[model samples]
Target: MARCEFCGVEADFPFICSYCRRPYCVGHRLPEAHECPNIIFARPPDHVRKIFEGRLEEPARHVRPVLTSELKQLLLAWLVLGFCFSVNSLTAPQLFITTLLISLGTLGLGFIGHELAHRYVAR
Candidate 1:
């Protein structure tokens, strides 16, 4: 077992400081805790800004109007999916229509939102 240099405690699993190259216990594992002389090396590098520079620079896209065919297809899909999903809940005739409508609206919106998010992220 390695020993902590600062506290003189024996450690089964010791933490080695990247800056000072010294073994330390959990209590004094960090550079600050062990009072490392080369403390500047412990600081993380700020490379995110440099790495992602100009990556998000994209031209604005023109908003295209939805076609009537696309609207019909979406509605048809939503209706079919809603009926299939709500088939199990058909025991109560009163709640059958409500469940179907709710399923249709939620599934349609959820699918649209998911696609939008994917496009935005993949851009």
Candidate 2:
């Protein structure tokens, strides 16, 4: 049974917001005119707290379209860095330091690329 997100009362007929798709029981649900365009309506915070249970919980699914592409591009970029790190590891006396620096730089680039993909592809 759908319940009000805010007050936790059983809902007669929950309204699923077009943006976020969270079920909101009527009384707890804010009226549409008051909602912000940038903010998708969500189940009450307590509901999400119950659903997630912990701060470390992973999202149920990777619903974003860019996640796959971001991961693929990040993998390829890191693969190239791995090759370079391997070469440096063989030749350098300070292998650990160089590897750490290169790894951090690669991660930074990968994050930037991921953000770019999301920005370009997001609706």
Candidate 3:
């Protein structure tokens, strides 16, 4: 059986501290409780910490547009059209030359419509 590194109590299932590489009981499992030596090295550098703290102090600036109901419908239409085009093309190859041409045309139109919808929604 393994033992807790801090309190020396027998532990059936000890939690391991990642930094110090020591097994500890639930009560002293955290790095701070055990006073882990590697805690100093584990911290981010001063500059990186300052940048993160600065961002937290600032309010959100940008208001990005989310996907509305119309955008969702347009995206769904593109997905369904693309699926149909794929199925038609695969089946059309075994059918006839005219069928193949028609499938190709449908696929092209679907691709163009999908691109146009994407551009419209983005703007």
The TM-score measured for candidate 1 stands at 0.40
Question: TM-score-based ranking, best first?
Answer: 3, 1, 2
Q: Ten-residue segment with the worst summed lDDT in candidate 2?
A: 42-51
Clashes of each: 0, 0, 0
Residue 87, candidate 1: Cα error in Å is 21
In order, what lDDT does every prediction score? 0.82, 0.61, 0.73
lDDT of 1 by residue, 25-100 (tens): 9999989999999987877866443335657544457976777665677667767888987888899987998888
Candidate 2 clash pair list: none
Better of 1 and 2 by TM-score: 1
lDDT of 3 by residue, 90-112 (tens): 65555545554465467756766
lDDT of 2 by residue, 1-123 (tens): 887554566767887656655667654355463252435443344433233455555446746775687578766766666656556576665885677567757765775677678878985
